[model samples]
Target: MSQTHSGTDATGAPVNAPEHVIVIGGGISGLAAAHRLAGAGVRVTLLEASSRLGGKLYADEIAGVPVDLGAESLLARRPEATGLAREVGLGDDLEPPAVLGAALWTRGKLRPMPKGHVMGVPGDLGPLASSGVLSAAGLARLPLDHVLPRTDIGDDVAVGAFVAARLGHEVVDRLVEPLLGGVYAGNAYEISLRAAVPQLFAAMREGRSLIEAARGIQRRAAASAGGGPVFNGIRGGVGRLPLAVAEACRALGVTIETDTAVRELRRTPHGWQVVLDGRALAADAVVLAAPAPVAARLLAAESPAAAAELGGVEYASMALVTMAYRRRDMTRLPYSSGFLVPPVDGRTIKASTFSGRKWGWLGEAGGDTFVLRTSVGRHGDEADLAWDDTDLVRLSREDLEAAVGLRAAPVAARVTRWDAGLPQYPVGHLDKVARIREQVAKLPGLALCGAVYEGVGIPACIASGQRAAADILPGIVAAGS
Candidate 1:
């Protein structure tokens, strides 16, 4: 039974109106959906299992300077994230990185990241050769791609296998592995070509040189957008995006309750009933935005096929170690933003970001303090994650010393561990996602959205949420009438 209240629709006549919507999960996706629903004059209630609203988009302070503890930037080429930031009054705060360019800490030295490459698949051999990221034999093997037979990619293929067949294993190990690992935290050879990098996969289907395909992608993008900044960040931290969206939702009369986990979902004759500890809330429409496991549990009874698929989704764990050091002590820091380390090199950390140099706001806030962060552990390489925070921080410091020759002890160090944070998109991931979506669609007034179904970036999550909200709007309106 929905608790309806008196309200006026369009013409000003008082009527019992507005369908109730219960959005499970209070992360960016759920908050975005609730905001849209409330804006459309639907009664919205959002529930989160955790104490916080932002999931991976978290913010904190280190040595009295504000910083993002989670994701640091948004893909600006995609409008969803930046547009939502502006909608919630963060337009002026959208900023591009102050420092540009990154290097690879491979071959026992720092090498400039090769230009004209899509995720480390080089389109031009000149830059790759000059960068010295690959061995002499590796460099010689790349020309073979022009005359090599097209590698058959049926429904899907691993990014590493496909690239290696055309190029060489050295390119996959030295270049592609580290670059792709930074995003998925999974082995490049295990990740899906179609799901992970759709544009490159589509080009591969054309049966031409992989280099030409990458060049075409680059040229097309440059011509269309004039090579705009690929990413953007908020003035303070990207984490603040969810907070601002939550605020906007509240202003629109959305009821948000944190630490309120939904126990189960039951389909009723009129609508759906959301079960909690001792009470049930009726909703005309529902959006399931929790992580895969939690979403699986809630949908097991109603949609077993979707639940099983969601349960099978694999996740990768990683840790971020952020340290702040006195600017006076940093004598040998690299000029670039930071660098990525190939796993084949036997390095403890995968990547590092110079927060102070990359984000101007952080640099301004820190004053004499220089802040940077290092990431460790990935899907199958998570043994080090079991180590205590102290160990993780020490390992990070050691890698920093070896990479940039900086031995100064940090004034303050912080370690953040995300267990099972990133989901892996293996071969046939697109088909799996399609099956899950199909099974869920069979249930009326229900939809699902999160990092599981589509891309895992900020803009992608927001777009998924917006799509979910749009999907249920018509059903919600009809139910209320």
Candidate 2:
């Protein structure tokens, strides 16, 4: 790989030298890019806007335990997150949650999630019928799914509309919205069915009915002779994975600047010019691994089309309240991992996880202490986000008490707010992404990657980063030729 540092000394004349690459943002996506490039023998520099390295994958020491403030779990079925963990030598740290069961807070009670249900759409009705979470009328309403006509609109549709059309409105309001609400932190009325659950939609497109598709899936699983895997988390915390990645990047001799934020980018006859603080740095190639909005601001002037397309993507704010309590003070303890509250319930909290119960190692073994994590706010729920930490904690505590009958005040508490955390995959999201890609392809030596494009989970972010690295490395190597 070529290495170079060149700019105007005191005059405005350009100077020629070997090429070096610069990556904007130090999140997982950016870190992955820099790590990949440096491992391939390319001189790379990584710039982060914050004083710390991890963007959303952040953790802090609380009462002698590491508490994750951002992402907390990874899907075992997704290989990208697991593969990256192994590459960074943190694979041994992988740990599964203690409980595989989840509950739903509905009709003034906490009910266990029905078995054989994939995100609340029952693959097997036996469990749904017996679960008692829904009324007999609701259960009777489900069979209507088989008679619903196939939607042949050939255009993007909202998740709520799609679910209500195929399944009943009860399923959309009581199940799908809340389950998906926990994932995307957005309203199901606006979230795109194609972008949010492409597999489910594909099943509909192929089988002509959700019931048949679900039955087909169940038969396939039974034929495999084993059930699917459950969700997993790290033994220590989710932050450990990012820390390991940072360590590996450092060992590879990649230059990481934590407090350095790239403010602007200007294209030159040679490659690209980046402005950080008040200084300008030139690079042969640039990879924008930041959030869509942030990346849009940087490229607004250089590539108008790309900037407009990127700016079109929307994001919402989310907040998490983590609290610890004494088990003796609580009258009832849920047997499941925790519960999700549907919007129809008119609850302030979206979901709550029994951290100590969900994962065996999260709390002291056979101890009296327990930890619970609650989430709040979304696109239209910014009022909750605007609340002070104290108010937020109070509101969450009240909601927990009513929903689960836990009367004790928390022994320990911490609140973390993300102004624009989860990206909203609104209707026509895939088409917008396609347009963004088309515009990005028009610019040479430039690549964009992050959760905004493909997925919003840890695995998807890792995949985006690796894909960006693959696209840029060969060009960096060939530039020297």
Candidate 3:
């Protein structure tokens, strides 16, 4: 860990150092990079623009309990994030969701998420047949997917179009759209299917029928030991994971400077020059792990091609309202994790999670306390995100009352707003990403990684960071040799 005011090498040499690296952005990606570099014996400095670390990994105490305002959970099957956790000695802290149940708010009622439905696409017909979430007519409409002819268009297509074409409009509007729409805060009509759900696309390309593909997957899993475990989170809160990562990085002697924003990056003859607080720091390698737009601005003058492509990626704004109330105030607590509301419902909220029921530790035996997390916003409804705290809470409360029978005032309430947080993978996102990668590869001693490229979840961010670290460390080692 080195921070030189004069931007010179350790030997006080005015020349460029062989193994000096600077990682911009102190989020999960930046932390992962700095930690990896330090572990590999590379001198690294991580710079963050915010007053505190964890850009979108924010957590604060509410009513004496930790509440996550940003990312809350990680899919266990995503090895990158979970692998990082284990490496950082936080593996034991991981816990699966107490209750695997979830609901869908439809037709002005709360309905359980159809069992055996992987992310809203039915894997088994039995669950869909038994699920009251959809009518028998809607369930019958799903079999149409088997007969749907394959389309050979070699261009990006919206998720909505793909779902509607393969399945029925009811499946898209009632099942797939709202569930996925809430996750991305994006419009299925515009979001790219390749970028959003590549696995489903691959299944379609390979099996010709989603039902057949899903059945094949089930058979394979049953024949084997079993499929991967469902999603999991930290026992305390999702914030603990980042906190542990940051701590591990610090323990490895990585210098983390929060509130130090990197304004620009310039290519020098030997290495790179980074501008921050009107001061410049020179390093052998630089990693831009910030948001796509921020990264674009930093590299605009240095790599115009990369910057242009990065700037083209779009992001959507979203808001979360977590409220705590007495369980007795509600009509009945469903044995479900949470519920997703379809956009066609014209409701103010996109989805609502039964925080207390989602996990066992979150609730008590015969206790009356319950916490609910409600999300608001999508591509067309950006205005909802712009609402002030008062209005936001009011709107969320109104939706809660209609979705779940909540009448009592919340004992606790908090609102978190993210401007341009959720990345929208519009049609052709992969092509643009390819171009960006090509331009990035042309630049020596520079790497780019973040949620905008591979995935939007924590696991993807960690994977991106680790991959960047892997790329930068070898150069450092060879330079030192």
Best by lDDT: 1
TM-score of each: 0.95, 0.91, 0.90
Clash pairs, model 3 backbone: 101-337, 327-368
For each candidate, the alpha-carbon lDDT, in order, equals: 0.88, 0.77, 0.76
Q: Give the TM-score of candidate 2.
A: 0.91
| Tens-place lDDT digits, model 1, residues 1-481 | 5535445435767644338889998888888888777877888999999999999999889999999999999988788898889989999999989757999999899999998899888878899999999999998899998998776578899999999988999999999999899888999999998998899899988876798988888787778676677889898899999999999999999999998989999999877999998899988879999999999999999999999999999999999999999998876888778999999999899999999999988889899999999999988999989889999999988988898898899999999988989989999998999999999889877989888888888888888888787767642231111
TM-score of 3: 0.90
**Per-residue lDDT of candidate 2, residues 200-259 (tens digit):** 667776646776666666666556535545456776777777777888988988778888
lDDT of 3 by residue, 210-243 (tens): 7676566556545653455657777667777777
Give, for candidate 1, the lowest lDDT window spanning 10 residues.
472-481
Return the clash pairs for model 1, or none: none
Please provide the root mean square deviation of candidate 1 (C-alpha atoms, Å).
Answer: 4.3
Q: Which parts of model 1 are misplaced by more than 4 Å?
A: 1-18, 475-481
